[model samples]
Target chain A: MSQRPTAAGDPVIVVDRLTKHYRVADKDPGVLGTLRHFVRRKHRVIEAVKSVSFDIAPGEIVGFLGPNGAGKTTTLKMLTGLVHPTAGSVRVAGHDPFRRAARFLEDITLVMGQKQQLIWDLPTLDSLRINAAVYRIPPAEVRPRIDRLAEMLSIGDVLAQPVRKLSLGQRMKAELLAALLHRPSIVFLDEPTLGLDVNAQTAVRAFLREYNAEVGATILLTSHYMADITALCERVLLVHDGALVYDGALADLVERFAPYREVEVELEHPVEREVLAAVAEIDTFEGRVVRWLVPRDALTQVVARALETLPVHDLRVSDPPIEQIIGRLFDGRFEGSAAPPTHPPAA
Target chain B: MRRLARLIGLFWSTAVAGEMEYRVNFALAVLSSAGGLLGALFGLSLFFGDTDRFAGWSWLQALVVLGVFTLLDGLTSTLLVPNLGRIVRHVRMGTLDFVLLKPVDAQLWLSTRDFSPWGLPDVLLGLGLVIWAGVRLSVSPTQALLALVPTVASCVILYSLWFVLATMSIWFVKIHNVTEVLKALVAAGRYPMSAYPAAYRVFFTLVVPVAFLTTVPAETFIGRGQPAWIVGSVLLALLLFAASRAFFRFALRFYTSASS
Candidate 1:
């Protein structure tokens, strides 16, 4: 997709060159350094988020993709006004999140997968009512909105149970419902589907998509689950070591980094390894099947040649999985660092 | 106003429910807390045995002060202690992130997050002693002398003082020791300020106001009512409450949630 300037005016969240550096104390083992450490404490600066920029239009669903410690969570925290950026400008709903003014807080909500906002020992229903009062939503509308969300998420029964007794996925749904009960226009979800089963993950993804459409809420989600990004997000912002590495359409990212589809052929018999190498970089080779990393544009040509020349029996070609592409991208070894494994790569 | 109070009540009940999950631990905790106050009362009795009217305050009057202090201490421990203890860990672990994103004031949330229903025993025992003192010293303690109003007001003031110090955790990230220090100060309230001298009352009533926490309030029931004491206690409580709120907001400026 070509770059298109958003017409949504100034973007709901416009973060430019955001940075966060934490000062951690430095100490050595043994009683000597420990003793002196208290007298003259020394600190080392660790940059957690370094010069990241992104813009999300109204109603945009963007995925923040990266491995752990990639600053995805740091960026989300700054956007939600939960944390301050060391340097840079972050304006969510046209107000500085760090300011944490009542108006700005009212327009946004954040959900953390590993953390919960519900009162742990209370029934979710009680927590929901509390949140309603907290956000000052009209009492008349709270129950209906809550009921609709509960029904849609299939969490109505769980709402009566204590939060501690509910399953992780159940608690997560309740959290999401409570978060949206205030009708926030901008939602920040950090690892919302983590530790959930595949079915629960799918259910959550669907609910999020529906909620965004119904409420016109802009969503920025950070998840290590590539399937989450592949299924729900239109665009993805990739962060690496506290910096924005790539920001564009999810499809475009795969297209750019994984520009080629992988092709694999199962030969009738084990052939000389040179023949497999001659066609393309042999990804893997075992008894009969061999795999090659070939450009998408050259897939047809390579497959045709392999079928004709090599005692070829069967062959297939497909785009590399998002997980493999991402692993290669972070490792910086996608480009000819080593020969691809020789095997019939699964589509 | 009712809605807010009800929300706080629910919060309190939830805390009780969390603790109830472990019945053995909860029973032991209640017993230990009760034992602590029993020990304090026993110590007070021993001291009274030596001098009935030490420092111009009688044995029963001293016990009144001790009773009020135990009640106030129980309230702080059951309601404020657990939550205040968690402030540092919340800041370090980023749990405060969830608290802030909510629509309520961060200070209000932290102050009311946890409550220990087990501490009810202390309140009951304290009330029994206060009534027993009231009956023994009845001497037709007039409507004016019944100091129940000011006594309750003083409890509110003392609790507010603790809230102020606990809220300081928002500013000084390593304020886990602040509440412990406050508890130590409360321990000093068990004895009469008159024994130390008039100067200590002035210091505590003005500087830290620890005296009003128990002594001035207990004095109300013991026919030590003074209009000046009532006015001073209320004014100081309101002033301290306002100052604590301002300090809390000031601390918010430096608060950077974790991983942000």
Candidate 2:
């Protein structure tokens, strides 16, 4: 529930203590188990999302990060009114999302990477036309709006082609075009760049940035790729085991979780381990090169002393990669005892 | 309302354009329709072997019942099967989430999302049979137009039944064959209600409602329908349509979309 103060404006999305529980049927494997299940069924409740609260301001791009089954998609579903929340309140675009009022629906769009809304056998333009009619977009504006989005996504050529005939990247871009055709003010994207090549991922990222810039729409995105987050989002919300673990600036997260900087040094000659240890904690060394893990507070002093005392040929200082830090966080390396519940492995 | 109409227009045009990609399927559909009609006529002939009347109705009057059944079957193929048949797939694949996210009514969207022109030949042939039979019977235009009321009512009733069964996929998730069972039961509508014995007549009329679908409409076509029955047909259609809408909304409450 921890959140930094949002920018000054009426927040477009206000989620308060949102939670969801699913009553899943529990069954064992084998013929006997099937007979027993058929005769006497068993059910268990799974708490998918727990008391998650956050506010998103207009025109803000927030990254929602989580591991598999961390309930990221569940939260997005609640916000989009696709699934009802088991408990708690969600207000998006000044209306209760589950009510799904026409006005509220007109103001929001959701794009899931693994699912598509476009007709597979039809040309992409056909699906877009249906969207225009569903959203009641003016006849005069539909063509221009489509052209503008197609140009931005660089998917103008594929509009007339059947969706199944397009490449994965082209299909994803077309999905985005269909989703955004109504000019929704709030866009919820779940793994929008998933399974795309690096080049396609970068293109999608760039298109999102430019689209957000042009429309000033609020965006909440979830992606397994850190590059997607780093490129488009300045703020991030990290969820683990169905709970919000961190919410703030992405840089602040790295700063807090990873407290040391990596300094690589190339020595003029092989240096004794004791000499390098005197300046900073030695991480690794090979012949003339040494890597040091220096605390943030001691970075300046350690670098200055290294130049004064050691046979330092060239030195470079930088923070560890964000992926490594986030990976460690999820591994519970920092908390030591944050063990998640485990169920019986599926048969 | 206008937006809904426009959306339907767009949905069907796109659907037709997509189905056109397989022009050969349309030819296959026409051939199958012709073959099916011939088989139906042959089956009807079996009941009329030493007598020109079946269940107290002349051969021409019985042809009207078969025509109504053919028309409904065509409608089923053109709209119900192609659209409702996908509800199970959508529920399984999690694409229904996108359907609910749209600004339009989810039931309407699901119901009219796709159209197949493959069933058009059956519809035309069915209408032609009804007209030819009417000509042989020397029926008046006013009486023929009166038959349309029950025909439209039959269409609504059939749609509601198919839709209600399809909506059950939200819970069952794997009942694609359930509709096939319903289709088999509805096949009884191809014959007049009088063709069955007392027990079967009651069963078809009350339980499965095959009587109202074809027999009642045929009765009205030949100018022998009871006023109470026509009123009952309209009322049943309206009632079932409302129930289908309510049932769909109720089903959605339990629609735990498949995990992404």
Candidate 3:
């Protein structure tokens, strides 16, 4: 039912078989080898990104999902033009990023998780002013935009305070404000909600949703947090072992991995282990609760048998969490159920 | 030009604000810089006592070279050196992603983003000695003419030379030790190039360009200037500056930030 194309014109970001490789020296640990390395060092080629390709349409917030070291960051880096690709091509806003033409930089921004762009010793406002000057944004325009972002992010006071003194969440908010000051049409958000408290995460997520909706800024975000993906993106790109395994709606990912619903039962008294075994595949059993993964067809039969034959006080049926589906996909524990295609299906 | 001036101003204020946050460190930095300068001057005074003229040049001329060399050292140590170290760290830690995304030339941004207010004192003291040495040299119009051309060319050559060395770091990630090599070569600039004899002087001028610092400048001010040498040095500086820019662009092709 989904109508997503591999490459589309309305797409803001397009990558075709993009790859990046680095050559690094190698040396043995022996004294002789160490001395020999001084004279002639060995080298190896590391393929960080292996022919990864994807297309992101305008105004779309696509969650780029992958475990650490799975080429997620590499792909993001290539898209943003922070790193050059060894092979293939990437175009954002119809500009080659690695060329780093002023026109290309003006249309995009990248927010790294652990790193910061703010001057460590200066106030956030001062840093923003430098960026403003660099972007050549008129002072009249910069002032009002900064004021509006500060108001929305509730960081007016922190802008005057040195960045070193700001709390982690406050710093992130300021960082986001700094990145967006140019009103870039495309944003590469690398773990933007990382290391943030729940309140702050909610605030950031809210701000992102509002900003994207308001400005139609296309965002390609990479985060391990399922909440971030589920909340912000209609589509999710799953990368595993440096390859794109799945790229579609988030629910498609869930349905592809876990088609069965989990049935959890709370018993008045302890039930025999054999009874649960007969009911379904007993995944885990605690004091008052017994959890089982039964096929969607068997869920009804199992629940009926448990109610008829065993002591069942309460029961709840729910789809597995997106995190669990992702875990299973990466863990190689489950094969593709390959759910029927659906258009903009609920994720 | 306006943007650069504003950026430099803001850079100074922010550097001061940041340093003030660590008050003890700032105080120590000032003290150490002053102490270092005094120690170098004292060492030179002791050496100069044994000789009336070093390689046929008076003590005043040598002092001028030493002062200019110290000023260049201050510039390198307090700004260029520190920023280069930071650039390597930023590359490793992926903070450079933040820099690349900014709407500015990343190379220009990285090179000049850092400053040290303490270095201003060295410039003041160095220029003072140049004037003092000029008075001692009889202040001839010909001497002044010779001095001005070579000194400007020397500064440009030295600055551009360091720029090329620092830009190498973008491609040769393992050359973080390049700073030590640069520092060692800069140390040679402390002595007048003429004192080293003809062969050594030629080597310094062509190979290391240390002659650009003292010998060329001192030659002009000391009334022994050569017209061809001044023109060649200026040509060399322009060529080196252009080469550094080209090298920077070439290295940009290999830069893949950790974020990417």
Candidate 4:
């Protein structure tokens, strides 16, 4: 649906065959090799992004999923204009990202969790005010806006503290708030909850959810935490080896690969294991419970046979955990399902 | 322009406020900068005690060059030195991504994020030394005013030179202490350019431009600076500043495509 110019509305972010190539120096390993490299160095062109194409509608919360070096951060950088594409094009908020015009910048915010813009030696409030001033916000509007955002992140006290003194979580919250102080129309978060404890991750996720609901701003978040994608993003874009592997609803991605239901059966008493085993492959066998993996098409038939033949008190059929589903996607088991490399390897 | 000023004001006030919290550290910084200047000058005076002229300059003229050195040192400490190191660290740490995302010019933001008000004492002390040397040398009012042209040009040249060093970091992120080399070379400004041998004089003046940074203004204070000195300093400042600005943009382009 997103690939086509939909009648639904215009896409806020459009990428048409966007690509990025980097020439990297290569060196042989060893003291002798180093000496050789010093005389004659080798270079290789890295295809950081390979003709990836996608569109994001306004107010869409889309997760960019990938392993390290899979071009997730690279794509975020491209969209925000921090990194330029080697070929093709990217249009964000109706402007070329590379221009980095004030109007375009005013409508966008990029928060890279690993990189902070806050003045380290000063209180975070100062950094936030600096952000406001950069956007030319009025003095009257800056304080209240910062306070509101800081409070939303539960960082009222933390904002007054020097950034270096705060913990990672608090500092991330402050950075997030400062990046959003301008209330941009688009928000790009690259690993925003990275290196955070579970509580802090949950807090940041809740804040993002509330923020999206309140402002309806389009958010593209990249995170290693599947829980974040599952909680906020109804759709996701999966990138592997600098290519778009899958771009669809988060549920659809699982369904396309998994296409099975996990049936956990709780029995009233012990039964011959063979009776349940015949219905479906057994996942776990305990005293009172037996779990089965059954294809979606055969779910009904398997459940009926289990109930008729075995001593079953209760049964539940549910989707597998998203983490397991995603793990399988990356395991090369689904290589044919959504093949990553569209072209053959270059010699 | 007003917006830029407001942004600078915000950074300056915040840094001052933060520095004020560490009173002992602030006092020590002031003491250290002033102490460093005093020690250097003490050494200079001891050397001058034996010689009537150092490369044809009297003791007081030598003091004028030292004062310019002190003034430039304070400006670097308060403005360029801390901010350049911050930018270098950001590039290495990848925190520069946040700077590039801002609506302001990335170079502008990187160059002006800090202000060490505690370093102001060195600038004031340097000015005091220049006045004392002026009185001792019997420099007329017209000559003193004439020196202002070269003094301002020297500051411009020094800033542009340091910026070129900072710009190199967008490509070579591995070098963390480029400024250490800069600080070492800046020590050359502590003496009259003429005191060095002719070969050394030509290299520092043309290549590093340390002569314009210190000696030209000192020469003007003694009414011995040629009119060509002012002309040459202004021309050098314009050329270097433009080149640095162009280099900054080119480096940014390279960083955008190559560094990711």
Candidate 5:
């Protein structure tokens, strides 16, 4: 699954049993509960990230995927030194992230889609200048850095416009420019393309790819969009319930989890459900079309049998959407129904 | 140190540019500041209507305290309120994550990121009143120079107090009103410490330390400052400033960024 040769010197990011626990106050949803809470508060400790461990090589773009509360963002926060892990260890760029030494911070950047650091009332350039000063990029280098990034991001025109006036896509691009102005060696992005139109999402993905290629910066990003992962990352780390469920190539993930393919049949006439069930597991049935979920090994046999016996006008076989496969995986449907094979068959 | 100063200059310049968008607000700010100053002067006059001295200090001496209070209040609006007051919002919105991720010191960034020129009117008027009172008192040049030490110390103490309160928002994310309460108490600085009752003076001196914010500075300005009080004022400012920085670091450990 990992076709790229591992970096020579060492992994840029090392995480061994990294974890975080948060103590959250508990209260019910009534005035009486509020009174009770006020009298004696009760705190429950939640293990947000539970002993998750994975290493990322330099210049590798790894997608962090999970359902809400899966600790992907929490893990990113710890790696970026925004939050301290409760247990285990994480070393990024030869520094303990929790220490957040200046040298360590200079080498890393984090961008969260929903949270913006730009000043709302000011022009995007104003915020960029502040970033420049904070990062101590020499004054002479600031303009060229901004110009280069703005060119890559295609946000040059909007840099002087107030952030509030720019579209969400423009603002996100400007944010990327500011985040990358210092040329960090590692970038942590949480849903960078979130809430953007399709074209904007594509633009941001392209910018990230170009930036990574140009600077050779390691990137770890989490997004709900499967296209983002497929387009940007060859490798992915999937987390569920505060634990690492899978970490491997994107292709391997599809092969291992989605062992079945979808076969769509355009029938000449309607067929009985019982008769169709003999050929394959029926996914959907209508007047003249039938869809079946057939195992990878049995797909050809099932299609042959369906064509021979059934009044088949046409048939096509393709893998299910990755989003659907992952959604079902998290739903625990695949676990009970089509138990994943321990090892992927030889390709 | 030079780098920090440069950064602050950049921060304030950008802040001014950002604020310039609302040019009319500056006019309103000046109007309100003038109204506030006049109201304060009127209130002070009530105490001195019948006598030149109250609480063993002349009216001019008390006006010095009022001037210091106005100066500190202006500084608050200019720096502390605009910057530290947003800590709660940042904590709630999770933008504090960006601050922490920056290579610069988070405390420095948060404490000096904003500047409001609306307070400049109060600052200038306050300085004018202080100098006017000094002229009437025949204050020597050395006394004026010496007075600056405690004035600067008062600014530090005031900043530290505001920062400590703001930093608590990490644990209690809705503590905005708590800072307002501190402001209400610090308003006591408008009068000399001797004007207050014994209990009020004790609370102001020991608990909130409002006495050191204006009264001690005013005493120094009038050339009646005791050496012990001046030393105490500087020491208190340094201690509180250090404590505020330590407190900010401690609070950050508990910062659970708002769940995305």
Candidate 6:
């Protein structure tokens, strides 16, 4: 939402004040409103994204971060040419995304989380071959690419089985391979590591990093998983309420927004409430365990004071969790004393 | 054109290869088609037993008409019907986004991909029934060849008609119920258009052209239809096909591809 960082790198994807607004019918909450809506439908506009501007450079993986319904996916859809922007302009790979030219399509691919391109009843390889044909890839080129991808993902055997028979992780691996068979220079991946276990998640993240390094493909990835952004993206964009809130380096964002280090102190016994409260803003104090949200600007002084006065049994100082930092941003409130809802949103 | 052919060939081969894993399913499909052919023939015999001519057409001629209807309908199952279902799923689940992102023509791939190998048996059975009826009527191979002209036109018209229906799903979801109405129209073509009341006969013959799909083809073989009808059928097919293409493009403009 703030900062004017000097422009850097060759921009492969340029989005200039992109916007998308959907016209949905307005419905009443009650029976009378329902009857009125039925007689003469009232329509309302939902602005999914508004005046969003960003540039993704060649070989750079940019993280798109947002809460549900915050227009992260909408931006991706617009960039990938699946959803046309209601206003503004976008160019990916030197072509207008809205035009969706064959050349543009050939040079870009979008892989959505939990959405499948694989044919369910067919072997994963069968689906890949079909995709190859549709892409007009020479038949001879398909086998070697598929072989190499399968080996890289360690999914050669997985591809031999029907898609429905594979576990979720294996299916996702195959899904990524299917999308990448065309070797598009520009990739839009929305939650590519979703629903994967820790091992599978790590495997997919490693694969993406290697692919980007080897092929120099520009990747725009959106994920609820901070690990995905942290592991693969050097820069991150924060979207909130249908607008760009932050666009800069990931570390810069962490430094600017997450201005606190979390400290959890385990005491020898339950201490007087006044003792812990006097040292730092107590996050929680239960039985013998105590926690403090220490300001990052003064983290050293805060911890030293706590160590000198408190009966420290076990102490831990760590950067605040990604969810908390992002959550604080979305809360649109910088006063760290008060907390936002910590419960995960319903899936 | 060669690339399109290659694409279709690969899609079909992949479908067949996947289908081959379940040999029992293929066998059952063959049996089902045989049973369906037998049932249609039995119905024809039952109606013809009452008289040599029903609505001024012999039993063999009626048999030929039924044969044309079943054959076209069966072949449609091989590609069109399954593809329609796939399109519906894609539209409903927002998976159509992936389809739109492909470098190929979305409509072409959606129409031709993943045909049912099992439907091949029904096609063969329909062809056999047609030849059997031709033999009973003493129709020559030349007559069969002549009938092929209108038969091909009828298939083109039928595909266009079905395409129009399937394309509507882009604008309005839940068009599966509309295909049942099409089945009723196809059933009307199982006999001569003259078999219905005069008003109803004219409606089916000209307006919807259901009669042109089956009765006209059968009449060509029976030496009762004129060559003009063949030309008319081809013209109508071309007209409807262009209309369907336009309608599909118009409907596609409305596809939001929204996750909701």
C-alpha lDDT score of every prediction, in listed order:
0.79, 0.88, 0.79, 0.84, 0.88, 0.83
Residue lDDT tens for model 6, B184-260: 77778877787789999889987888988998888998888787898899899899988987887677656788473
Tens digits of per-residue lDDT, candidate 3, A37-133, equal 8999898998877777777888888999988878888888878777778999998999898888889999898887778888876689889988888
Model 3 interface DockQ = 0.53
Candidate 5: misplaced stretches above 4 Å? A1-5, A265-278, A285-290, A303-315, A333-347, B21-24
Q: Write the per-residue lDDT of candidate 4 for residues B70-130, one digit (tens) a residue.
A: 8888888889887887887778777787777788887788888878876688888888899
Q: 3 or 6, which is superior by TM-score?
A: 3
Docking class of 4: medium
On TM-score, the candidate that comes out on top is 2
Alpha-carbon runs more than 4 Å astray in model 6: A1-10, A26-40, A260-319, A332-347, B18-56, B135-143, B222-228, B258-260
Give the worst 10-residue stretch by lDDT in candidate 6 chain A.
A338-347
**Span of 10 residues, lowest total lDDT, candidate 4 chain A:** A338-347
Candidate 5 backbone collisions, by pair: none
Q: How much is A242 displaced in model 3, in angstroms?
A: 1.4
lDDT of 3 by residue, B1-260 (tens): 78877776776677666656666775676677678667877867776687777676678877777877777777776677767877787767667777777667776778777776666566666667677877876768777776788788877777677777776766665556877887777788887876677898888977888887667777777777788877877888888878878887787677766543
- lDDT of model 2 at position A155: 89
TM-score, B chain alone, candidates in order: 0.88, 0.97, 0.86, 0.92, 0.97, 0.93
What lDDT score is found at residue B6 in candidate 3? 77
Q: Candidates 2 and 4: which is better by TM-score?
A: 2
Tell me the lDDT of model 2 at B110.
Answer: 94
Report lDDT (Cα) of residue A66, candidate 3: 85
Evaluate model 4: give its lDDT.
0.84
Q: What are the interface RMSDs of all the models?
A: 2.5, 1.0, 2.1, 2.2, 1.1, 1.8
RMSD of each: 5.6, 4.0, 4.1, 3.5, 3.2, 4.9
Top candidate (DockQ): 2
Candidate 1 residue lDDT tens string, A158-238: 788888999888989998998888889999899999999999999999999999989999999988788888888888787
Off by over 4 Å in 1: A1-10, A119-123, A137-143, A266-272, A296-304, A307-315, A332-347, B16-52, B59-64, B85-89, B131-153, B164-180, B197-207, B219-231, B250-260
